[model samples]
Target chain A: MTSETPIIVLVRPQLGENIGKCARAMLNFGLTELRMVAPRDGWPNPSAGPAAAGADSVLDQAKIYDTTAEAVADCSHVYATTVRLREDTKRVVTPEEAATEVFNQAGRSAFLFGREASGLDVQDVAMANAILTVPINPEFGSLNLAQAVILCAYEWSKTQSLSQPTLTEQLPPAPQQDLDGLIGHLEAMLEPKGYFLPDSRADATRRTLRNVLTKPGWNHLEVRTLRGVLSTLAKRDRK
Target chain B: MTSETPIIVLVRPQLGENIGKCARAMLNFGLTELRMVAPRDGWPNPSAGPAAAGADSVLDQAKIYDTTAEAVADCSHVYATTVRLREDTKRVVTPEEAATEVFNQAGRSAFLFGREASGLDVQDVAMANAILTVPINPEFGSLNLAQAVILCAYEWSKTQSLSQPTLTEQLPPAPQQDLDGLIGHLEAMLEPKGYFLPDSRADATRRTLRNVLTKPGWNHLEVRTLRGVLSTLAKRDRK
Candidate 1:
């Protein structure tokens, strides 16, 4: 197992059995860490143990989060498994490509898989740097949650040796928390200017802004510079 | 959806739900042809339809055979999925390599996956030209039948366009029936000469013979030539 292996984050998963299955799939490809965001059923469901099929350790160490933001706070690269047609600006990638990029880049990555039926919502997708979609038969594309997770895990395993220890001196992308702080600062400044006017379209506008901001994958230093710029711009308003 | 997609053959599969899951996995990757040999509960299993998760077309078109030999009789290139540790002479390849070769080679190919619990028997493995092994985590390698099938199907899908139609001129290896016929003929001739002595070791000896014979992948003409030679030698012995 590599240190940079992406963590699997299931957002609002419905069933304990499915969660257990996802863990089994991840372990099969050598992925260990699992995080869940607000599961419908509370953690430590007795049903999960029998379904894990001997991958108990993954479930045992799985960390629970109150929200997706908190789950991926430390993750520098976040990928959303999109189940719906989205016209967002986020770049869509196949599992194979996502694995390659994750291995080559220096960062802690997390792949967010939404609820089994509905998949990620607009807010959840807005947090991702890229959309990961599996190319399936257009006629019959019915990959279950575990199946989808396994494919991504398998692809990631294939590129396990791709990252060299000193391949890049550049810092990895800033963690999701830092990026959120930058976005939050910008939103606060823009909110008073009527940039998000019309309550009906405010959600869409915010999502678009997030899509654009997250696309840059700014490093920690760049994010700090941008924050400083925002603070300076805000200071002029007080003056 | 290429015509040369390898057929998935399950030999002596035990469960109906697993068969259905396999169908779903195969369809997700554009593989529609499914063959089964000696399913424990018999064909048209009632339980399979529900588990297919709307991949009914795949299950609806599945073909059944009484034996592994017949299941792959029309297939030109036979690949056996070995689940156990084997020190056999046959070449073992990863699913990716098998997919590449299958696409490049001009032949109807078949992949033989063994029973859910006990993978293909020695005799079944001997029937194959090569072995297919998934490179999984050594410690926690718990890939169920559907998981294994999906990984293979996923890998096979990756090389869908790798084969250009006009690349090979040499005829594809003769359909498996031709090879089996040749083996049958040679076996009959050698049976009277005490070639397979010691009843306890006969099965191993036969497997060795099959492994040697299948390795060559002789085309129709080559098989025909060998058959004629066997008949001629038999005639001389009778005289």
Candidate 2:
């Protein structure tokens, strides 16, 4: 359930830049499998490298096929992405629902996306086991190829233990003793500025200030930075 | 809970195509409000129109600001979307967690995205009430501007009742009788084809066939189409 990544198939994609962007989106979520069926201008377009930003590995390994059927022939589950009216009676599911199914199902799965100007034709839709649609505004249902790929990729990524940029290894919170030192330093700087002016309410104001400062659970680096900022302000007054 | 949409503020976004693509992503998830803080190429960029596809309204109504502070001046809650190290100790939440908070908490919320190359500076992050980070591949956390925007917008839209392109006014499942007829038609076609050649296993095979056909919960149209396919196959042998 955690490691299975869906293969992205672009059906008759028009632009090289879009193909590169799709690769970028796929790599963002840890997906690397990409299949292209009949790219209009052919493969290895020079414009793709810069557009991909840095996801060139996905582009390098992308497989090309002559038709949609061949692209997804190995997949046990196939999902076609489109907003156009599907004449066939294929079961349609939102990207969220489709992602859940993809995670639960065994074997490789493929997500098919159509061309830029026009979507998958009737024959393409018929080949898919299901239709994956994003809930979009009716007035403006224009989703670019990368956007569509990303919506599905992001949803699928949620089911996996992908590392979040913020969740990566970070500095531990400063110990309570260090935090107290930081609070004391700030209070000392504010005391001479009349920040605790009224004696009657001074105790309560100090407590409130302490609560605000402690709420963030500042790591040592943050505490050090704030102390530096206070020292700079103090030095300005001396000048 | 459904109608609340977050304001997307791009602080110092470099490219017009990226801005246009951001609008396209926002509209795909029913988000309309977009604000820009000093885009490098300038507002009403000539290149944006083509990149946006048909999401012109989102681009048309997009507001511009000279600074991040003024862009989120009216927002009660502001979230800074960044992967950089912040000197300030702000509470960080993943996009999934942030989307839940945005739906539950009342008041207008804003998400600030930084430039493509450098990301949000310390000043921009300091203004935000909290930090929002997408769980991405750590080795390559290079999510472009539009990819970041879509990740947040898609997560937020999951909390709303935005009409899914597939979930809108679908036909109900066909009656059991209709499905039974479809199964019978296929069985009849298979009868003469030696599909059930071994008499001893014919009964078990029929039951297995029924189980596979009934799993999809096909609507009337699908049943009719399957039956049509069966009839065509039967006629093919006659011709």
Candidate 3:
């Protein structure tokens, strides 16, 4: 859950031209935060300058990261954009749904987009709490990166002033790092007890667990309580 | 008054690349009809092909006109797209209002866009029944030709059934009884640890915890997962 204007995170984006176009698209809809996870041509590319079409501020201020996880660590609500819905338990939300949620909820939200050739990897998708899918023309659904970014940005921009006046009284969900700590604690405990046995299914089991935990959108206080619960149970056993 | 799909008219557009981009943008939102009035480089421009990307169909079927008046000769409701509101009697409508009007009224509607450097001329403004403007960021309102075209196209697409499916997948919040059971389980576990020992404040602390837990409205699956987690921890302690 998040009330902050969502940031755009491009994961392993390929072209400098597309990156420039993305920056332009984002700025067009009043979005400024641009996080890139390992660009193919590297940052500060000459091709980007010409294509940005005067959105250099977004590009100039763009932050780069080595991995998707690190990029979204501060975000509380992370949305992964996918062309086609994968067979997963994660909830699928439209651009409008996501836009509305951002305004009414309480934490920082980030949208994730994969590279040019293929969309986000299975691992990257697992990292996101939900999937953001744009329903386009079934006959000819060909939305490029900039186009996709524009739609989400446009939807979000629409809600800035007009969002429901009533804000949720609930606390915002814990940041990604906090959730990671909780998940890590659970994994550590479950690991020695063979909860992740048959190493082949470990990755999938972990992803399923993540999807289940993420669905609750637990607040920091709740996360802390759960963490304390774990410690208490563990300490009792140790004694 | 127009109920038919709105047609896009590019008035004396200067660049073929921009024309191609407009075509791509239009096709993205399921808008197919594109009209160009006196393109600078002439018809069948080479640069347009690459920029159109996969929207060749829109370009192939595009109608060319000698003037803006001739372009909308067959249309009844004409809209002039301008960067600024003209000081005239014309009713200024947002892209969304224009889109809603397009679906509600009767007769053919056409949206007119001007050249790359300069927008629609006074004569072109006079031809329209209303002016369609996108309210963007005042600080940086530099929307390119294709970007402008896409925003209008995207708004128009919203009225159609194209976006109906993307909003149906999210599960509803779980029932109240499930929430109570999960809260009870957590409280029972925490009780042994003296979490609610102070008799006077115990009720208030429990209420706070309940409020935090209830805020998420976790679905049955999530509640069940929490129950399993509590059981797992408690069973471990006993072992």
Candidate 4:
């Protein structure tokens, strides 16, 4: 279970309430390990105890430390969560990507969210191999600490697949007609230009073009871009 | 901005920490209103203070009610988050779809997630207009309540205009329209054979053909297959 569960660390948490909430988020995502560093309010703070809700077990058993380093000392992998982007950080990951890494860890991994107001100091962020950032609207991106934990926990939970899903949930969206139209346009323009002529050879050309576009998911913008390229090429052939 | 916020109602929340964390997730998404229904330990539990960390403001302002309906009384819409799919309840929605509703809401809406262990009873889900469920791996879909809040938050965040996303964040392209042309070509062939001409006027036939091919988000493979069909038809026509 330790392999799957990430050890959640709070470095210099200034509030008891935040710690309690973080613990709650941890429990929500199947993570039970809680570690704290230099909490402002002393452990067993009455505020934190009741705030933990059903996650009291995590709060009760939470391991406290004097520093971020000490709290994550036992962790094989550590991630620091922050909203601010830094110039020098090594691995910058979205919460989902970070969770993917945590899911892959061989031993105990720790996800650290800093204090309430100031957030994790740059020095503390450097302690972990990776930094996890939530993509928020830059205009109003002040994500609270517990919010960060919840996002992290949510991504982790998705990987676990805890509930049965309906048929729509199981299947991806069906493909549409726009793609075929564009390809047909390209082929129509190309057929007379010798791009694909022999009736049998046309099949191979069409398959090769299809293979190139279908591997990764595409959206309207990319489709437009590809159409532009094809139109340019087709025009050149006309010339 | 209660209008844009998703209401987080905890039903019989057993611990202060869990409630605090839930509050944390709400605030992160700019959701501040919280309602608790008969928390086992009590409202304004002291333990929640420290656990709330930076989200103390959310905890400080939390409201407590006697029932789920009371908690959602002021909201225009509500979605209950549940792990179990009860046999009797109807109107279930995936969390992603729920986020879409919250984003589109003309007024305030609430997304309710239940407590740990036993999820929201069927009666609770029946109270809401829709039931919100997350699609997990199924093998391990049991998500903690706070984690559910986080996932909702993440999906909502994606809709936010958070600067231009990196190229990698781009979704797959919808299939182009070349396939529709192929379908049209085939329909034309069938029309000559009286397959759809006499009984179906050509203009009416064309409309039905277009309707059959039109889909919301088609991808590259789909268009290619249509083109392949056209190619086969061309080969046969040549023979």
Candidate 5:
């Protein structure tokens, strides 16, 4: 299924730094479209560049609108993000649920976020088809703008075919023969040191040692390096 | 299932602000215990407070250790967070998978985050039971300190019963009677306008209309509001 990314609309955001940070958060998850509804400090705020770190593309293509309605006018689905009490009745869904709906539906979706101090006005929320809220600490619901943006963006990204940051090709496990050789070398050294004492328990002790060594699923390179360490220790004992 | 919240250990972290932000990220998902290993600028850095915003309790109780081993000495399980190439053999798992394992195992777990620039070294990874990595963009794997902390914390929190930020007791769906009232009200207005034009397919058309209205699963207040809106539209037609 093609991923339907929603346009992020920041309604009257106060700081350029926060805008930049929000841009960084969006690009981190592959969301590009940004719409601003009457920014307090105005668009192209000089302070935003440095804060964005390197997400210049998001900041570069950010579109500004006069009002929330105009910003989301073209959207088939609009989710207003707010934590305050609403006077109008609207369906409330968590970020995860909203993201699922966004991906499932085929249309232009817009997520509307309110100003810094005071969130979206009643009219702004009424314009939205639904409300998206994050599961935050009720006692301290103090999520900043960028934090909120990242939470939503991250959830939506999970539904898409985004590449995992750390899933690179891994080396296969070492051959059993090589592992056994390394185990034998270690056992030979330990036998001289009397590390496995008590003839009655020697077999069980060796079995336990083998289990610990094999648990890591060491690759050939790791096995070689470990054997080298054991050889070095043995040579020191000879000295 | 009981959430075995992992102890976050910062190994040779450079900045106080980043440390504070990490604490904030941890608390955001209900992971509280934080241990710092040899902070460069020393503990209780003034810069951390403002950056942390209001996560004072986490910072106030932050523990400092001389080494990574000391920090995680008491923990039964240790996960090292890193994005670097390792020379050792260790099973690497994604944050989601690691979180699952963490919650399933019945013991104290510690997550170690390395310095901002270099990540965890070989020695640090060797100490860990497993490697925890986030799936990030290969081209730009520049996840800041707080971002990384929050990602793992959020994933782990999902396995727990921590109250969602927006899960205030919602009014159950509007009763079937109320929903029927809403459907009837809308149909009454549509009937006069001959919305069901073809007489033969009028029943099927009405069913389709009902299906659309019920899909949103509107609550009682939402249904009442829609009915009010319909009445207003009808009154305007009369005018």
Candidate 6:
């Protein structure tokens, strides 16, 4: 479990049993860390025991917090689950892709699920570095709290290696350049070419482009090819 | 839109916003009937108006119910989504399989998602002839409320014909033992055989057996034929 283990933070969960069941799901994928933020019911809830089935240990050791930020404060990375799409939201990942990144990151990670009623308010979603959404039907896309966690956990479990350290660690970072630096170079090339109009929107567009490319777990070869394409476009515009 | 159109049932949803969002998901798949079982904030909730974005019709025509049974009373079939698995729970169908079954039934159907954290209680699941579970990772399987409904709605939408349906008045129910009955019969048959012995605890064996059969979509005739073979063996044992 070591570095691969994830901390599950649930904000304002309305039901004690859901907290318990979330614990059960985490155990299924060999994850244990649990954090609760301002849960509707008091912690150490008796209702959680039966619902957790045999995963009571997770409930026993769960940490409590007053805010979403506090729940994930110790983690190096955080992913917020949301059903509705926000136009201004940056760094959105489909649940499958987020799992890969979560497994690859070197430090502790946390995934947050909000209350049953309103879900995570925009404020909660904004707190996270990334937004994680399941590719659900545009119509009727309401998912229960525990179900969302299971999908993420399922994806993470799939990427786990048996003999190898972890799927994420196997690749390591490219010696030549990191994802952010390469993205920055590409955006610089595009900026002069009017690839993204309006100075105010340039950063957002570049970030969106970078977010899309990063989803595939790009390598040196792919990044170089992308950079080359940007260079060619830049030269043609200048001519 | 035929039985192929999956119905969305919000069981005792406390918040009107969730009910509205759930209706929006249904509308995404061209489903319109929104059944609410004892909503906490009452129907035509003002909070739901904005959260639904542009799905006011779903709230406008929403149907309210006193209980889950009442919510699904008109439908020929029902499915409940639960967070944790119970021993006596009906056979679990993945969202995809449930979509296919809905198409086959050629009858009105309801898929129930319960209150945020508690999920569907055992009685709730039993009411539905079957339990529908989204294929989540075994570990950390918490699904946000709207997201769960979205997945089922998405799968249900996929099986639909994009073209406008020619007016067909009625269709026959496909002949098959529903998954719940077939699995029960299979478990009973296995019990007499050494497949599940005094040493192998019936509950564990039952869960394992259900898990195996639940993966692939089994039609009614195929399930009946398998049960026939089991019945024949049981006959010999009785002699």
The candidate maximizing TM-score is: 3
How many residue pairs clash (N, CA or C atoms closer than 3 angstroms) in each of the candidate models, in the order given? 0, 2, 4, 65, 7, 39
How far out, in Å, is residue B140 in model 4?
A: 14
Name the top lDDT candidate.
3
Best-to-worst DockQ order: 3, 2, 1, 4, 5, 6
Give a tens-digit lDDT track for model 4, residues B1-239. 22265667888888888787777666666666777888889878987877565678778788888887567655555677876565422356777678776666544577776768787854456455557776543333445677677677768766554343223232222322343354556665455445443564655445434323332223445556546544543342221
For candidate 1, the lDDT comes to 0.82
**What local lDDT does model 1 show for residue B174?**
86
Give TM per candidate.
0.81, 0.75, 0.86, 0.49, 0.76, 0.44
Q: Evaluate residue A17 in candidate 6 and report its C-alpha lDDT on the 0 to 100 scale.
A: 83
The DockQ leader among the candidates is 3
In terms of TM-score, how similar is model 1 to the real structure? 0.81
Compose the digit string of candidate 1's lDDT tens values, residues A1-239.
34488999999999999999999999888898999999999998787878789999999999999999999999999999974558989999999999998888887999999999989988999999999998888788889999999999988988865311211244567899999998898777677665566889889778866755575466676677567545544432211
Models ranked on TM-score: 3, 1, 5, 2, 4, 6
CA lDDT of B229 in candidate 6? 35
List model 3 lDDT by residue over A1-239, tens digit each: 33577899999999999999999888878999999999988987889978888899999999999998889989889999987777766778988888988777777899999998898998788778789988766666667898889889888888986846746787778898888898899878777666565899989778767777776678888899778766755654221
lDDT digits (tens) for residues B1-239 of candidate 5? 34457889999989988998888888877777999999989987998888777888889989999987678766656788876545334557777788777776655678889999888866566566667876655555567778878878877877675442332254434544566687778777666555565789777556555534443345566677556545544432111
Instruction: Flag regions of model 3 displaced more than 4 Å.
Output: A1-3, A161-166, A237-239, B170-239
**For model 6, how does the per-residue alpha-carbon lDDT over B160-225 read when each residue is reduced to its tens digit?**
765222222222222435777867775554443455546748576566556545533444444554
Evaluate all candidate structures by whole-model CA lDDT and list the values in order: 0.82, 0.77, 0.84, 0.65, 0.75, 0.65
Docking category of candidate 1: incorrect
Candidate 2 off by > 4 Å: A1-3, A85-87, A162-239, B1-3, B41-50, B84-88, B168-202, B216-239
DockQ values, each candidate: 0.12, 0.16, 0.38, 0.08, 0.07, 0.04
State the local distance difference test value for candidate 4.
Answer: 0.65
